[model samples]
Target chain A: MIASLRLRAAVVSIVLLAVFLGAWHLATRSTGTAANMSPEYAKLMGMTATQGKSAMPGPLDVGAKLWEHLRRPFYDNGPNDKGLGIQLAFSLGRVMLGYLIAVAIAIPLGFLIGMSPLMSKALDPFIQILKPISPLAWMPLALYTIKDSSLSAIFVIFICSVWPMLINTAFGVASVRKEWINVARTLEVGNFRRAFTVILPAAAPTILTGMRISIGIAWLVIVAAEMLVGGTGIGYFVWNEWNNLSITNVIIAILLIGLVGMVLDQILARVSRLVTFPE
Target chain B: MSIFDDPFDADSRVNAGCICGQHRSPAEHEHAMSALRCEPVVESQEKRYENVVASAVLRAVFPEATTRRAFLKTVGAATALAAVSQFFPLKTATEAFAEAGTPEKKDLKVGFIPITCATPIIMAAPLGFYAKAGLNVEVVKTAGWAVIRDKTINKEYDAAHMLAPMPIAISLGLGAQPIPFTVPAIENINGQGIVLSMKHKDKRDPKDWKGLKFAIPFDYSMHNYLLRYYLAEHGIDPDTDVQLRSVPPPEMVANLRADNIDGFLAPDNICQRAIYDGVGFLHILSKEIWDGHPCCSFAASREFITSAPNSFAALTRAIVDATAYASKAENRKQIAEAIAPANYINAPVTVLEQVLTGTYADGLGGVKTDPKRVDFDPFPWQSFAVWMLTQMKRWGQIKGDVDYKAVAEQIYLATDTRKVMIEMGLTPPKDSYKSFSVMGKSFDPTKPDDYVASFKIKKAS
Candidate 1:
């Protein structure tokens, strides 16, 4: 029965996508073939102007461009132009580097804040003020202070990713059950050992949840950061195509961004599942 | 055949001379001559360098080609060089020029918005102008004029392709902290146009533009000033009668198609792209408002110039060299191809060709040709700067008392450009100030206050 339900759900998803695509295709179909235009004049006109095609590209146009990109996805022509695979790799690389750095700094600081009441209160005001600010807002400041664009982009990602993990880790560590700590203390476990063997294990699920949230946020911010400081990345690709007003390439970039974001989320979700323990 | 070839020698043909003197045009002669006299400069590299320097100094002292040639013929090249070296440190200057050829920093980054206004800066990279000058320069395609300004100011970029007024604005502390910036060279002139959406094709006259929204690339851009001037001349107050938004050049076409803007005064390529997209048609070229008006510039900070003078000079030489090549009509098609790659301007070849070649469809089912639609000239005239300042003050961007001439001379590096032009064997303009008219009203660079006061429709001070 469960398998049949899954099959029915998949069928519905496919049906919805098909209907959407069909409507888009019909809406964008060529309506008038430009008649009586000289060959020389037609050569200078865009596809829409000459063939009476809609300005908005249909799914087929996007699909064809996507297929061309997929066939050779690692071509690096120069700094401004790179293949989709290379662009994606550059973006993922930045996100991973930034996310890992955030994990390193946030986890330890979070532990200190979580374990001590005084530290938590002292740091709370600063965190509260900073947590709500958009990552892109720091672009100009980061660029000015750091004096490097790529490093600034990575720094932006780190700042955005830290707040979520820091807050969640502190919350999880602070809320450990009193009974578990009492049992560990009574057994003569040293403070260090207790942290590693008991507190860490007890808060593993929550900490992993925090990491998962951070990875998602980091992925989201990388696109915007790379877009702002363009050199070589998926965000740069979107911007380059947008400069030419190539909607088809932009659609492909959007689709790729969504897919990459999903993959990053799934990886963290699986890690979160690994740390979750049944009572 | 070459500028360096001796015009005094009866055996040599110096000024676009055909092998048989039967070619229909200079371009045809060049095509037919091919590689015959291209090896005219057979001197050693060092000798050629000294010769160029000597000739420039002689030309400067004489100010007349005939007298210089007569002097050279009388005393011979070696004696003439020795005589000049006595008055001027010829040997020391030659060594310095040679040393400056090896740039202090080899790797550099230049920021540019992907537009035809940046043709020389962009083409310099792909066509080996930078490499030839012993620098590996990466022309990073920037997102917008604001980002370009920020990145350059942060020292992330070595230099940048900027709107002509940007360096002035930066130097004067408008919209950004006052950082001493300099315009080493003007990139292109007369390369902008006012494009109206196809729906408003009949509304060509500026008087009919009231209640319509328009987009300019930036608040301090030539596009904004020209658009405002055009409107004010037509009795339409830009501030009260119509709305103007600061839209980046790249997004103008999409915005026009989306019906977000009725028109835009932007770079010629953006104007061409709008017509290519069938969303807009050319209302009037900016050249119609003011021909030979400065649009974009090759700018660097004063800090960069002080820290790395040699590299800055090399970069400027590459730009000036590329500008000279792009000035000729025959080279336009080749340049269009070189800058059309995905890594550069990233536009269709035909769109670029139409913009560069100055022959394009007007989106009204008509083909119009105007070769001077976009031309490259690298002189950074201080008079242009004075004109811009007057407009800035008139538009209320600058308030209180102003020293227009001092500011213009400081921001526009006319002296530096003159030196570079002489070094390259090109004639530098005698004076940095010249009067030019905008919309039938002449501007006297010597009297900027008068010009500012004369604007009838301006932001009331």
Candidate 2:
């Protein structure tokens, strides 16, 4: 019965996609041609004036462009024009470097805050204030202070991802069961060993959950950060296409961005699942 | 290393002693010699041209090579130059032949907002003008005017394509910190237009545009001042009569299509793009208000000019060369194809062709041809700065006492540009200041205060 339900759901998803594409194709079909235009003038008018094509690209146009991009995804023409693969690699590289740095700093600091109530209260106010400020808002300040556009983009990712991991790790570590700690203490395991052997195991699932949240936020913010500080990234690609007013390329970029974001989330979700323990 | 050292004799060590006995060993002397050789060996452009001209004159004077060599050996090279100068105007010919010097720093990054006003600067990168001037320049497409200013001020860019009034505003510390900026060359003139949304096709008059929303590229731009002047001349105050927003040129067409703005006064390429996309129509080219008005410029900080004078001169020569090339009507189509790629302006080739070639569809079922819709001229007139300053004062952007001429001369660099233009074989205007009329009102650079007072619908400061 469950297998049949899964099959039915997949069929419905495919049908929905097909319907959407059909509507898009019909909506953008050519309407009426202007026949009286001179050949010289008609050539300059583009397809919109001569053949009566819509300004918006049809689904087939977008699909063809997407296929063209996929065939050779790493061709770099210049500083402003690079293939999709190269742009995605640049954005992923920035996100990974920033996410790793955030993990290194936040996990350790969060452990300290979780173990001591006083320390948690002291750092709480600072984190609370920083957490609500939009990541893009920090761009100008980062660019001014960092003096490098690429590094500033990485810094924005780090600042944005750090807050989620910090908060979740602290909450998980602070809420560890009292009975497990007491048993470890009675066995004379010492503060260091007991915390590592017992407390770490109990909080592993929560820390992984925090990491999943942080990675998702980082992926979301990288696009916006890269758009603001344009050089070579998927965000820059979108901006470049937008400047050209190529809506088809922009739609393709949107689709690719969504696919990449989902893949990142799925990987983190899988890792979090592995760390979860059954009582 | 000594010339007197005998290598054949076992007792005499040739490689052991310095030539002048100034160093410990021959190796050290050789190292010192190489270091000296590395020091600026590339001659100045003028010097190189002079040598070539002097040699040609000597060859003409003596058809036989033996006789020319004998003459040079007897009189020496300096005496030959002195003799040649007596008969021929060698100095004047050399000045004419001198194109550009070897750049002190060849690899440069120039920031630009994607627009037709940056034609010379953008086209130079692809057409090899920078390479011809011994420069390896990368023209970067920036996001907006503010980013261009910041990147240039931060030294992230070696120079930038800026609005004609930006250098003046930057030097005066209007929007940003006071940085001594100079406009060595105006990039293009008469390249902007007022593009209105398609819904406003019937509403052609400025009187009908009172309650409509409009966008300008920047607050301290020629677009803002021109739009304001045009509106006020039509008996409508820009500040109170309509809503004005500062939108980047790239986003202007999108905004117009979405009904976020009713119109915009922007670069010609942007105006053309809106028409091409079937969203907007050209209301009036900027030249209709003031023919041959300055729009955008090639700007650099004073620090850059002082520190790297040769590179700056080479850059200026490249821009002037490109401007001269673009001014011709025949080269417009080729330039449009070159800059339409994703790396530069990132617009459709047809849109760029319409802008550069000045034969375009006006989105009202009519094809119009006005070759001077956009034109390139590298001369930075100080009078343009004076006119902009008067508008700034009239709009209350500047307050109290002002020295218009001093500021204009300080930022415009008209005299320096004149020298460069003469070197490039392009004839610049004889005088740096010229009085012109805007909307039937004459503006004399000598009397800026009177021009400001003449404005009836001013900011009332």
Candidate 3:
């Protein structure tokens, strides 16, 4: 029975792969044909006049470029020079630092406001006012105040990431059951012990949901912030490619951003599942 | 006692009491006692002990209850204080200014575009010209001319290498907010050229720019106006007869190569790149189209210039020195190498050298060594500014009429820039304004408005 199940799963996977590839092939062929006849595509679609030149490379060419960039990518083209690995590292470093800082401040503060009625009443207006402001609006101020691109970009990420985490954490903490509090009181458990043992464990799933939301926000803001700041990072890479008029590179950067965002969300999902009650 | 403890009698009495409580008795006091018995007593005891420890610890830390409100107030105050202390380093600001001298403001941030005109600024920073002047210069590469103007106007940038017309436009309230600006020095002149794709190299001649799809970096840029003048002189209407789109300098060659654009107006290095790439050709150098037209100038917010005069002078000196170095024949190759590696205009040194040397190849098997190909005259304010004002008037960018001279003076800081030039042993123009013949017709400086109104090309209806 196990062997049959494995065989069925294998067959399903192969069929899905075939469908995906077939669809991709059909789409590319149609787009290529349409592009050749269109006035807009005339510029980028034709063959170069060079002796061995061919038509502008299709999807296969993009795959080759991606593979080449991935392997042995550490080349310094000059002073502001770095490889794809270094660029990705720098981008990820800023995102992680900013995201961690956001969580460190947001979680405790969220708990305080959630646990106390008066505190929540006092702070709710302020959060409501600030949460609606766009991250881009803070960019000019951040640039002048911080006086550095990397720091400014990180600050932008931090500003954008904090709100979702704070909101979610507050909701999570406030929703702890009255029965649990009563049981803690009957046992004469300290407030700190009660919170850690009962409230936090119960709130884990919600807190993880906040983190997942925050990470997504961080990723979204980092690209735009880096583009404005302009240094070494994926955002810079995207801007540089656009400036160079290398649309292929821009598309690649977009793909990389999407892939990374997906992975981060998946990791957060797994963490949430690990902490939540099975039932 | 043995006689009294009868089992059946005792059981019957208890059963009767329970039945009475359930049916006969209206009050249920016995049920409450049973519910209390099922409560977890140990859990409450543990909670009490934990709360006691936590309270003790809190008292040890701070003897005041201060309520959560008071504590939050303290935290809020502390955060405000910490934020102020952490972000603003006023002491460093003074020290940086003091060490650099009053001539320059402390912590200087200079903005530049990715073009040959920005060479002097780039070279000066790494070569420590600003550092020597006691200014800490951070060179930032801007996206385009519009951003440079916006940032400078808003005081986000201390100063910027901007288009010659930008300060004038700002003074006239054209593109930017109406803020007074000053040009401390003319950074460079005649660095711009119009490049055509290699495909149209043979068909479209430099003499004819009317039929082609021409790209200018900005709508109101000096190049756009100059191109318009050029086409009109050749009896072609720039508006209806030709297509003009705004394309950034760096992307010009690619656009040309892609055949999306027939040609574009860009600085010299970009034109050189087209030649090197074997995909484009030089149609007309802007200098050739109009002799000694000002392309870019070093500008600062009027507030910065007035308050920090010494720093302004120091910056002017450094730029002047760099420009002098850049103009020398022997330094051409070195300048190319320095600029080529910077990723601003990532092209070969040879391409840059050709364009920088003023001996441009006309792509149609012709060469011209026009001595006036790239003139770096600092004080031709009247010609360029007046021309810009005229273009503005022509294009209806500025609708209402005002004193042209005052408008020009408000925009052009020629008097201030002349002082710096004199100190550097360069000849400053005696007259603030001058007139010159452009495309075989004399442009009168005195009658600037009339010159604009009399243009043969009809204004957009």
Model 1: how far residue A267 lies from native, Å? 0.9
Taking all chains together, each candidate's TM-score versus the true structure is 0.89, 0.86, 0.66
Please give, for residues A1-279, the per-residue lDDT of candidate 3 as tens digits.
999999999999999978876665455442322312233222212133222233233466567778877886677654344567777777899999999999999999888878887888888899899887777888877765665656878999999899988988888989888898889999999989988998899888998999999999999888888777765788877776665445556767887899989999999999999999964
Residue B279 in candidate 2, Cα distance off native in Å: 1.2
Q: Which ranges of candidate 1 are over 4 A from the true structure? A: A117-125, B1-100
Q: Assign candidate 3 its CAPRI class.
A: incorrect
lDDT of 1 by residue, A1-279 (tens): 999999999999999999999999999999887846788888898988898989889999999999999999999898889899999999999999999999999998888799998999999999999988898899889977887889999999999999989998898889999999999999999999989899988888888889988998998898899888898889989989988889899999999999999998898899888888899
Residue A85 local lDDT, model 2: 99
Top-down lDDT ranking: 1, 2, 3
Candidates, ranked, DockQ: 1, 2, 3
User: What fraction of the native interface does candidate 3 get right in terms of contacts?
Assistant: 0.07
Q: Model 1 chain B: which ten-residue window has the lowest total lDDT?
A: B32-41
What is the alpha-carbon lDDT for the whole of candidate 1? 0.86
C-alpha DockQ for predicted model 2 = 0.36
lDDT of 1 by residue, B95-201 (tens): 67754656788899999999999999999998888886779999999988888998999898999999999999999999998999999999998989989998997
Q: Write model 3 residue lDDT over B227-304, tens digit each, in one string.
A: 777777777787877888888787787778788888877776677666545567677778777666778888888898
lDDT: worst 10-residue window of model 3 chain B = B1-10
